[model samples]
Target: MRHGWEGAVLKLFRGKDFTFTVTGAEQVTERYRRVHFTDGGLLQTLGVHPTMWVRLWFDNAGKPHQRAYTLVDPDVEAGTFSLEFALHDGCASDWSRKAEPGDTIEATVQGTGFDVPDPLPPRMLVVGDPASLPAINSLLAVAPKLPATIWFETTHDSDDELPFRIEDHHDLRTVPRPKMVEQVKADLQELVTADTFVWIACDTTTTRELTSYVLKDLAVPKDRVKSLGYWKAA
Candidate 1:
């Protein structure tokens, strides 16, 4: 007999793990790539949300360096998920760079991030570093077609910078890396209106600074602005 309510309870208590075999890898740019997984039918059977953050484990130096990545373009009907990685000089990046098709890795489902807010505001502002682009793009995909501004900062000036398409209702701006936080702040101070909702994702320092400016300096309510620290400088 298929375990029903008890299985749900057991899943919550015992936690289920997902193992995926890399089916394909495509380099989209010098600093970005897409990896496709072809395992984890059980996780799909358990009904995992598309936006849920998953912990990935790769065999590197006999220690699993865990990193959080958003599930991109999950096809429940097809039993697969796509994870986009931003190549950097780190443990996860090293594994991703060397990983090939048919390689098996482990992952676990965890972490929920910002969902679109209700009673939607008239305008929206999204600001983040290149690492946070996937989350921003996912938000934009589901967001109602409205006037939105996205500010992205990256070290390289390349045509293939970000992977996703911005709707016509969205405006995108790019700046160099070192001054991204300041530029975003200045943009918000000038462009933000009473009906604007601001979403920010960046390093810890940037998140703290921008959160304070939006809440204390601009008097935007905490509810109207959401900020998250996607990573921190070492």
Candidate 2:
């Protein structure tokens, strides 16, 4: 399938394209699915990193639509990884719902990289939701020894059933959609430290709001916080 204009733009930016073949699949919950794949030389060509993601091209009513998904459990030696889908009414979710062992999908690897802080922070604060769960899991996995606190917002009742890599030292807080931002605001000040690392990835508005608060109000250094708006709220 042609990737359309998005492909053209990525190509100009030197993005690497690969074809992934589905190896297996599992239903984690009514609203979540995990699909396994063999990474068509992507790992060997570019290697792997924490929180690595790829843009997958899908067919949406005869038009090429692309969605970004984080690689779950990426094994460079095995050349394989899994992608978790928060099931919803969209081309990406539609493709995942019917994915089979032999199915193939085209993916582009670009604008996907992560660097752990040069000197690891004393503590890590992560704010995300189901949409960014895979990234959250991957990020935490890289720093298992670090003490971290996570605020995960839930949009569905089944969201609590989603997998999270919370260690004994980690504090995991679940907040409903409506109260997530407010709850974080009320509680975050106490958690901030001189070198605390704040990572935020959620709906655009929430990410922007919290990033602003952390930088302007809390006076955290700009380099200590990594904030990305994962999806725009409709």
For this target, which candidate reaches the highest TM-score against the unseen true structure? 2
lDDT per residue for candidate 1 within 20-130, as digits (tens), equals 888888888888878888757844556544245666765456544567787777777788877888887888888778779888887655445455666677777888777
Q: Cα deviation in Å at residue 88, candidate 1? A: 1.5
Clashes found in each candidate (C-alpha, N, C closer than 3 A): 0, 0
lDDT of 1: 0.74
Candidate 2 is scored at a TM of: 0.97
Provide the TM-score for each candidate, comma-separated: 0.85, 0.97
Global lDDT of each model? 0.74, 0.92
**Per-residue error at 172 for model 1, in Å?**
0.5
Q: lDDT, candidate 1, residue 202?
A: 81
Whole-structure CA lDDT of model 2:
0.92
